[model samples]
Target: MHSAIAPIPIDLIPSWLDVLAVWATVGAALVAAVTGVLIWLQILQTKRSVDATEQTLTLAREEQEQNRELIANARKSRIDAELPKILVWIHTQTRKAHDLGVRSASGAPRPLTELPAGKIWSLPDDGASELFISLTVAVSNDGPRRARVTLATSNNSFLLSENEQVISVGEETLIEVRRKYTIEDWAAMSSEVGTRSIQDVLTLTYVHQGTEGAIERWVVRQSGSPLVPVPGRQNCWQLGPFAARRGPLTSLTAEVEMPHRDYYSSMSDLTVLV
Candidate 1:
């Protein structure tokens, strides 16, 4: 019976070899596909790690910037706290006399450009006219310690005359003088003062040392009455007292002005002298 085994078929041998070749190709392709998939997954994981690290670094930088800003603010606050606070203020700008004036050195007429057109004012022999006034002011120290008042400047535009520009806050009333009708005219103008209010504008600049440093203020004037005691003589009113103040200097216009009238008139004196 062993000798009866049939011999292999020569034609079927090629078919078996072809099947083996096909299985070998399939196994190699599967290995390649698995390797490629694993490599792609590794690349994705590396990208995620890099992205996370970058985001963390960015957040850290932002936090660091915030901390730096906070530190700067704290430092500025400390500096501000360490600074000493001192201040000076204007107390009162009281009127002393109303008759102050100015004129050219020569007794002639000078056309003022500061005033309106066709306004020709005469210069008195004493350089006095109805363009100025006499004033006194009060000032105060607004600081914990003592401060010094040093310099003062005038802000005279139209009626440019001042006697005492430098004034103090503590000791006495600072008195200044200049152009216009005398305070004696107050009696004559009392009636007019009751009905209408008039004024003259003046500015005073003061330099002082304190926590807030040097400051400036306007000294203004308002009066209702002026008398033409002399025929056609003009009188400018003095400013109200406003120099005395309690605390620091306030931000205000303080626009007090004297009413101006026609200085040059052709009318004759009609009122009988009392």
Candidate 2:
């Protein structure tokens, strides 16, 4: 009877800590997921920013290259614009040289002056009996710092002029002087001349020089004679007083050594005196 009565009520204790631990575990899982998502988003944003910056830099570099090209082209245009004016000045000077030659030849007290006015000679369109003259007269700048000319000949050797006087960077000038050609008498020789015919190897030598210097001898030859000759000397027989075996012939060959240059202009209607 006593044992049965003792089966009294036994109380069970509740664990509050266990419930709190379960809630904490769920919260931690939520926090971890949010953190991982935020990291991924940050990486994507950083990549986008870098790509944008690079594209902007590339475009800016291209713009700079274009600007440099434009500047270079502008400079070239300016130089071209100035060239014509310079040429006009040179012609003015050439006129002055011609006037001087005439004054000196007239036996008048040479005008104590250098002025633009003179006769410039060119060959006749039909040709000459004794001279080969220039039809294509070229004036040119031999170097950026120098100028020169070439008298384009018909039957004579090339005529080139050296840069005699200094033509400054921006300065334009003309060179003028009289060139004289004298032919020695060829008729006085006896018919008993040497074995070679007088019609062979006859020629002369002339000179070219700077504005103020001694002239240098250049060779000349006639058109009808043998085109080739001894190198150093001008053969007078090349000048011709020839009796053609078959056909009638007129002009002879002549040449003048001229300088070579870069850019040039031409003047026409030059008159040549026999």
Give the TM-score of each candidate: 0.33, 0.28
TM-score of 1: 0.33
After superposition, which runs of candidate 1 have C-alpha atoms over 4 Å from their true positions? 1-17, 85-274
Candidate 1 residue-wise lDDT at 203:
47
For model 2, residues 91-163, the per-residue Cα lDDT tens digits are: 2111111112323566653432322222122223212222222211213232344322222222223323332
Give the residue spans of candidate 2 off by over 4 A. Answer: 1-16, 80-274
* Best of the candidates, TM-score: 1
The ten-residue window of minimal lDDT in model 1 covers 258-267
Candidate whose lDDT is highest:
1
Error of 2 at 241 (Å): 32
